[model samples]
Target: MINTFKKDDAQALKGIAIIMMIFHHCFSSTELYEKYTISFFPFKENIIVNIAVICKICVALFAFISGYGLIISYEKKKATASRWALSRYIKTFSGFWIIYILLAFVNIIFRSRFLKVYFGHGIWIGIASVFLDFAGFAKLFGTDTLLVTWWYMSAAVVYILLVPLLYKELKDKTWIILIFSMFFLRVILSHTDAGSFTGSNSIYAFIPVFISGSIFATTLFFSGGY
Candidate 1:
């Protein structure tokens, strides 16, 4: 397919989506940065749920944008892509653990879950699970969740794992199937779970979102002239 969507518009929409995610996570508003941003939308409990729905779209959309950016980056240089992939995996693993460590230290020092408010449990076990996502321990061990955003990083790891395959064989049809399957699965899971599939929502349900990101990344490759 031709690059029909306006590049500028897509970029703008991506910007909007990111900002929305930030707001949804931070203040749980699409843009609680300003008082008037959600002035039109009702500000009730249910309304907040509605706002979060829109924010989830922003996250899914951001995953797509991430895929778009990464695929294009890989296409530009093979050696660079390989290095980038390794570096990304290392970065994600290290980054998650580093944050987990800091958060655990802070929690031990403060003896408060307030830091836990944003992140989550951060003992040694949480530290390991948060970074490695080695769920093998999550059942026996506990979760850290110091930064709720760790979920995003966890999802990123999954998307990264698909890069080699996407760059090689699945760049075309496999990606399309992933995109469709994920979208459909998301709907099914959402209805069954009564919405919300972030952490432990479905025995680690980042697969759909991760693949969706790949689909978005594929389009970016096309639009980027890669």
Candidate 2:
């Protein structure tokens, strides 16, 4: 009968998401099948690919957990919302940038095919592309990301920037906020080149699920559901 989402629940959801991510990345595409040494399934390859495709929900799971955990933690912290968000922004990007810089270094040093493919023609354009990727705006601005998986970075930035700004408004009006997020997501999908599944790098595409998590947390904490 306990419906409360405790910190342990959040961590458990995260663990599940991570496992799904690994499965999705490992078997999602047939092109990469050659990279793996073993395939236990003797049936059609599409079966595994289909299962992997379904595992793409991992992104939504992670987003939900992020929204839920952020609201829960924010409610307990003594710092102002903006300050808390700033600290989170710094922490997230600092960790990301370390790996980003290292990857960029290796790419440039080796003149990897990634640079050749998405560098966007000229030197200035290439630099701009790199800058866009670094700032996590590549997907937002319709620029190419240096790495395919980095599309999530843009979504992460959007989520981090939005949570602090909307958490209070979502406190009592969770349903209203959730509806608005869904409407916003639909609008973005209708008008833009944003896609679903792996190409859903745009925050507008996934904001509803993210806000759903926040609403769940708000309900649990404020409605005596705990």
Candidate 3:
């Protein structure tokens, strides 16, 4: 029997992940309840908070989908790694830069305190950080920027660039790659400070979840079934 994730299957998974993300952002923190009342199940705040916390798996879901989709695309396209990576980056950056630039321009026009407060030190330092933010390297460089969620930007770029190389090297050995990714993630989490959400945004931290997706793609496409 053939088992595979069809296009709609992937899209449905993504929709579920998005809904989970919304729940996580809405109720994961008890502080949110302090600011806004919960009309539904108002007395079950603890249950809601716990459920929301578990919903954090949305990040892993997204990474897995990205890996699966990219690998499937690569398998179909047979494009060179550099070309594929460049195309993916261009697609990602096009949308990213539009929002990044719009926000920056708005902040500048309004003299919003975000830039001054986050991008610190002298004027030149602040300017350099802004450029880094444009490239999604500000968080990696430890230079604070406006958006905490933008850490995913750098993480996404890293995944796109790495996926082609990973597919090339491990296409035939998907299980090995999956095992290695898990081992690497454990080592990083156990040995370093990259366990927290902020610290976990490092480029290599979420490779396990991504590679799990790749493994699924390999099973479905390259190996021709499970």
Q: Single out the weakest 10-residue window by summed lDDT for candidate 2.
A: 217-226
Q: Which candidate tops TM-score?
A: 3
lDDT of each: 0.57, 0.75, 0.75
Which 10 residues in a row give candidate 1 its minimum summed lDDT?
133-142
Better by TM-score, candidate 3 or 2: 3
lDDT of 3 by residue, 189-213 (tens): 7666656532355555667778777
Q: Which residue window of length 10 is worst by lDDT in model 3?
A: 217-226
On a 0 to 100 scale, what is the lDDT of residue 132 in model 1? 45
Compared with the true structure, the alpha-carbon lDDT of candidate 2 equals 0.75
Q: What is the alpha-carbon RMSD of candidate 1 to the true structure?
A: 6.5
Which residue pairs in candidate 2 collide? none
Angstrom error at residue 192, model 3: 2.2
Model 2 lDDT tens row, 142-189: 787778888888888888777876676775565675667677776767
Candidate 2, residue 101: Cα displacement in angstroms equals 1.8
In angstroms, give how far residue 141 of model 1 lies from its true place.
Answer: 9.1
Of 1 and 2, the candidate ranking higher by TM-score: 2
